[model samples]
Target: MDMSRLIETPLHRLAHGRTGDKGNRINISVIAYRAEFFPVIREQVTAERVAELFSHRRPTKVERYELPRLGALNFVIDDVLEGGVNDALNLDGHGKTNAFLVLSIPVWVPETILQLREEITA
Candidate 1:
């Protein structure tokens, strides 16, 4: 509960994501850069949160599949493409932007994790 113990950062700082799509469904895979960060990413990033992030797309469903060994979380978002690339009115209907959108999600990390970096470089 101590505010000083936490730091907010974009998810991209702890992980990377890739976007894919098929028949109006969007798939995003988020992988943590370090094993130590996996648990935090898994705990903070949820399907419900992801659906909220892409609410403008009005996704019909959102599913999150976890791969702990790989330190990754894969999200399958349905009906987000507006009817697929060939049919969606949006110019970038491929859903390529979804990955970056998800990555921009703010993540709260323990200040200790941030301190690790400073200790390494000092």
Candidate 2:
């Protein structure tokens, strides 16, 4: 696969939000329907790799963790937003910044996984 094209594709942009704080870091929890996708997602979001993927913006920090039981991957990104939850609450009501931050990573998965997620949630 052409990695550059994949990174620049609209799918990636849509999967991940465009507006990132670029100043305050936040923790994002990503749950995959299957364990197989963990490594692929990790490779796409690694600190060094993410910098290149999001070359236009810089992140202060990126930490990855494995949720084996849930078949998930959790990422803690530093400085991806401004002022963290405090600013979000103060400025945007309710005080939740993590939701937007979590939306900023393009989590690639199969259609089956998407269906499974809907099923579980429903």
Best by TM-score: 1
TM-score between candidate 2 and the true structure: 0.45
Model 1 TM:
0.89
Top candidate on lDDT is 1
The reply for model 2, stretches above 4 Å from the true place, is: 1-24, 49-58, 88-122
Over 1-96, each residue of candidate 1 has an lDDT whose tens digit, in order, gives: 324588998997888899998888989999987787787899999999999998987999999999999999999999999889889888788989
Per-residue lDDT tens digits of candidate 2, residues 1-122?
Answer: 32322222112322222232333554555554345444455556555544444344356667766666765555656654445545533463222444454446555545443443455346
Q: Give the distance in Å from residue 30's predicted Cα in candidate 2 to where it truly belongs.
A: 1.2
> With candidate 2 superimposed using the best TM-score fit, by how many Å does residue 116's alpha carbon deviate from the native?
9.0
Clash number by candidate, in order: 0, 5
Q: Which segments of model 1 are wrong by more than 4 Å?
A: 1-4, 116-122
> Which lDDT value does model 2 have at 100?
51
